[model samples]
Target chain A: MFDWLFRYANPARFMGLSGALLPWLWSAALLTLATALYLGFSAPPDYQQGRTVLILFIHVPAAIMATNVYACMVVASLFSLINRHILADVAARTAAPLGAIFTLLALITGSLWGKPMWGTWWVWDGRLTSTLVQFFLYLGYIALWNAIEDETRAARICAVLALVGAVNIPIIKFSVDWWATLHQGESIMSGNLAGPFLVPFLVMMLFYMLLFVCLWLTRIRTLILERRLRSLMGAA
Target chain B: MNFDLSPYGAFIWPAYAVSALLLGGLTLWAMARWRAVKAKLATLEKT
Candidate 1:
């Protein structure tokens, strides 16, 4: 199984496989997003939050993916640092901007939801503060990657940054529980979400996850091709 | 569905609109960049 899996570790094989998978991943993303949107907007307003809760359909998943993608980057960075895998470096580098985008979306949407509900555009609550820190970590990771010209050196430095930054992930996760904050804790995990809201939320999560996977694969494939072209040019 | 949008409509509408614009814009930008990169690679491969 490991041998078969590692076969695609080669850039050419990975590109071929990803090329074949892209269309299907894209189709799944579109279909699920359509279904999620239909269910999200059509659902009845919450008894407490009214229509504002609809924002969670997008916000929650973006927030989840923001942290999860960062975690993935850290792991990929570790592989690049330890094993010196070029592919892992490419994966970590490509994922940073995407993760940052999701983190931004999460913060923007969360603030949008908060204004009406919390009566403020921004708050320095525990969850909010920790999430802000997470966003900064993403930005810092990207900046670190860009600051260095040597690919291997950049990957190693960024990997260290990513590892150090991993500490924020747990803080972000538990901030609500650890501190007195206006921001609410997990709705689904803690069973605070109702059946009516949960279905659409789950669907939206699936949609967003599919979208992330599709984007990640495409970005990694492009990076691989770029490196291949650069080496070919050098050889010529 | 029948709730009055007059009160919070300004805030809600713009939020949704901005999100849509950003997400759509980013999607287009990524795809365009991918295509451009692929074209460059193809040219290099040909040489």
Candidate 2:
């Protein structure tokens, strides 16, 4: 199982595989988004949240992707640190900005949802604050990559940071349940959401995952190309 | 299909709009970067 995966550690091979998979990933992302939108809009407004419930389609998915991408980066960082792989560092490096954007979207959408539901644009509750910390960690990760001019040194340092920051992911996940917070706990997985609401949420979640993979592949390809170009310039 | 968002329209539309703007903007930025790198790689390879 892992043998096939290890073979793609070669940059050229990884590039070719990603190139082949890109079209299918993009198509799935678009299809899932369209289905999510169709289902989300067609469902009747919630009795309590009203049309504001539609915001969940975007918010929930963004939140999930926010944490999910970080986990991906941590795994990549592990590969970079333990295996001493450049491509793994590139994978971790490229993922930071995208994860930050998703976290930002989650914060914004959550704020918007909160304004209507909780009558406040922002709150410093455990869940929201933990998520805000997650966003900052992403920024810090990206900044660490840029702040150092030495690529190898930066990769090592950033890999350590990524490992340390892995602690926040679990905190963000359980923050709602661990403390009394304005944010609601896991409604979808807990079977609290109605079928009409659940379907779109699930579809949107799929769309988010597909979208992240598509973007991550594209970003990693770009990084690889950039690295190749740099080496060529050095040779020239 | 339905434009009757009514009272919550103000909140809902802006939320989706912000999401679209952020996600779309990030997508465009990533694609632009990818294209730039690809073009640079092509030029280097040609040389």
Candidate 3:
């Protein structure tokens, strides 16, 4: 089983597989997102928070996926550093920008939501600070990769940075509990995800995951094609 | 739904507008990057 899995680790095979999966993932993402949007807008406003709670339909999923994607990058970086897998490095590199985008979305939307709820645009609380740090770490990782000319050298440096940044993930996760923050703690996972709200939230989460898969596959395929072109040019 | 939008609507509208702008901007950036990458690949192939 492991051997069969490892066989597709070849960049060429992975590219082919990604191409096959892309259409399906893209369609699924679109459909799920459409449904999520419909449900989000149609749902009755929260009795307490009213219309402002609608922001969570997008904010929560973006925040969750941002953290999850960074964790994925850390794992990929580890594999690249330990086993010297070019594909792992490629995965890490391609995922960073996408993750950063989602993180930025989360932060912006969170701030927007915070303004009406917390009456402030920004705060130096735990969840917000840790997420901000995660964003910077992403920028640093991308900068490291771009600054180094040699691909292998860049991968090594990025792998080190990714590992170091992994420490922040836990901090972000527990920030609401650990420190005084304007951000609310885990409402979805801690049994606070009750009836009507929970269903739409889960649907949105599914939509976001599908979106990530589609984007990840597309980016990785693009990277593989770029590499092939470079090698072909070098040969000529 | 008899509530006052006069006061909070200013904040609400801008918030939604910014969200639209940010998401739209990011989408365009990613699509542009993808196209650039594809074009480079095409040029190499032609050569």
Q: Pick the candidate with the highest DockQ.
A: 2
Question: Model 3: per-residue lDDT, tens digit, A1-236?
Answer: 34786698898899788878877887887898778767766666665556665567677888888789998899889889987888888889989998998888888877877777677878656667777878888899898899999998898899898988897567655864466434555432111235677777888889878877777777777787778778887998
What stretches of model 2 exceed 4 Å from their correct place?
Answer: A168-192
Please report how far candidate 2 places residue A204 from its true position, in Å: 0.8
User: How accurate locally is residue A12 in candidate 1, as Cα lDDT from 0 to 100?
Assistant: 81
- Writing each residue's lDDT as its tens digit, candidate 2 over B2-41 gives 6678798888899899988887887888899999998888
Ranking by TM-score: 2, 1, 3
Docking class of 3: acceptable
Regarding lDDT, does 1 or 3 come out ahead?
1
Worst 10 residues of 1 chain A by lDDT: A184-193
| Residue-by-residue lDDT tens digits, candidate 2, A91-186 | 999899999999999999988888877778886566577788889999999988999998988998999999988965676557644664435554
Local distance difference test scores for all models = 0.78, 0.85, 0.76
- Residue A230 alpha-carbon offset, candidate 1, angstroms: 1.5
lDDT, candidate 1, A51-148, per-residue tens: 67567777888888888898889888888887788888999999899888888888898788778777787866665677788889888888878889
Q: Alpha-carbon error at A178 in model 2, in Å?
A: 5.6
RMSD of each: 3.5, 3.2, 4.1
Residue runs of model 1 more than 4 Å from their true location after superposition: A1-4, A171-192, B1-7
Regions of candidate 3 where Cα sits further than 4 Å from its true position: A171-193, B1-28, B39-47
Chain A TM-scores, per candidate, are 0.90, 0.90, 0.90
